[model samples]
Target: MGVHPKESTAQNIENIKRQIGEIAAIYDWDMEVNTTDPEFYKWTQWIFVQMFKKGLAYEKQMPINWCPSCKTGLANEEVVNGKCERCGADVTKKNLRQWMLKITENTDRLLGDLDKLDWPEKFKKMQAEWIGKNHGAEVDFKLEDRDEAITVYTTRPDTLHAATFMVLAPQHKLAAELATDETYHCPKKTMVYTPSLIWKFI
Candidate 1:
């Protein structure tokens, strides 16, 4: 339905624009907006700067779909069946600096106001899901051999006694620092080690 701007010829671009104009005429649209306009993106950058100044945006390291061929990170939807949808390259988890919004700070007020809106029951439920608030307790566990403490969020804190092992993300410093070996000689009871990058500590 659309011709990619980067790869498309001038004729392709003109054809698509003509099709869109025909569609717009059917709806009697006042104007058509071109998303490739740099001026429009400047407004978005200004909005982000405002959010950053308000402490609503911050950078954090997070795992994302990485394409080796593209040498870039792809969104979750951009990865199809563990491969990059664009280049068909195998997608892997790579930690990259990502901007995060502190929308959770207003989740309470947002959820509270949803009930006051005149909407359908299912629509209100959808709004609640969009807010995505979770009631959980952040239990802090102290490391037995170190002065470090790990905090975990759980909706069921009562079953914490069964939490014999903790699964640390691949980006965790302990995953790289503490890993010495991978082979475990359980039968001979000689070697015991954590996984290479995915640490499953007991």
Candidate 2:
């Protein structure tokens, strides 16, 4: 919040922030660690620059509901019935380049330290689920007819003998890469197997 005065941060955004601050002061909700503090922001900028140099911060294409009229990306909620709520422009899928932080690099440590935090069991479980710190192995299964073998990550490697068929999520990266025709997503990861199912666990 403090450091990111990126080109994206406009005067209107700052105005809204100031307005929020003014309104909060009336209710005595003074935020201690203010983003407006230059002393705090400089350190943030330094840290971000260091992270960028270390390859921890990088850019990737992210699909989103885009509003061409607004010239800005709209959140799913901001799209009303396939149109932008603000300008009523038809929402479209766009692969916008976005800066992403490598939070997965710290996943192991975060998952391990979850028990040390003072939180309810349910909330801790939710955090763990979101972190996706699963104890699993990737088993490489070779296809019978084709030379290419798809890699599947599974928690139940013990059930390999019982596996009859595999199911792949329509949105899996491999789905598009391996598909001969047009394709598409699901929350839970899955495996898809064809008649060429041949197991070679690695």
Candidate 3:
């Protein structure tokens, strides 16, 4: 048996057509009929293609914390404490290939246009900070065998020593790979498994 629900082929197609028709319809109290036609879907698809062509949409392998009960991946922010938001099951980290959109690519233009728009000052400031417009150097740290390196962008290189040890996010490539090894698999062995420098710093 499949882990998910199953429907007959006829039922599935009928359901799809029903949903499409319902979505395309607009109801008015005056009984006037309005509908979102296939043209809307075509336009949406065209815009998506434009985004992809501009490199704003791309696919990459990314680890997501998955909640089996929900049968969906949860964003790191979605987990409360250590449990899934939907089912209260303890969330587990899962690695999978997923799509990533370059939201940061439009950061500067969005931030610049914010001032021209009549919005709340607090909201504007929040948007500006979210864009993270900064004059800084991007330093990369690489592993011995890996050609790729982790980049850290910072304005103050002098405070590097104060950093103690790098705190790699659990979702980071390095952190996830290390987590798979027996030496680092034990959560209770947090200090025991972490590098001596990081352990001391933590």
* TM-score for each candidate, following the candidate numbering: 0.72, 0.52, 0.59
| Ranking, lDDT, top scorer first | 1, 2, 3
Candidate 1: C-alpha RMSD to true structure equals 6.2
Rate residue 165 of model 2 by lDDT. Answer: 59
User: Candidate 2's residue-wise lDDT over 1-202, tens digit each?
Assistant: 5555653355656686799877874534455464655777999889999989988999987666777789888888998877889988776656668888897888999898998999999999999999987678898777656777677898989988887756554433345555442222232222122111222333
lDDT of 3: 0.66
Worst 10 residues of 1 by lDDT: 183-192
What lDDT would each prediction earn against the true structure? 0.71, 0.68, 0.66
TM-score of 3: 0.59
The TM-score ranking, best first, is 1, 3, 2
* Number of the top TM-score candidate: 1
Candidate 2, poorest ten consecutive residues by summed lDDT: 188-197
lDDT of 1 by residue, 1-202 (tens): 4867645655666787789887874634446454456766788889899999999999998777778789998988998877789989777666778899888988999999988999999999998998889888998877657787667789999998876666665445555565545521122221112233333434
In angstroms, the error of model 3 at 159 is: 1.4
Off by over 4 Å in 3: 1-44, 75-78, 142-149, 176-202
Compute the lDDT for candidate 2: 0.68
Provide C-alpha RMSD values for all models, in order: 6.2, 7.8, 7.5
Candidate 3 local lDDT, residue 1: 39
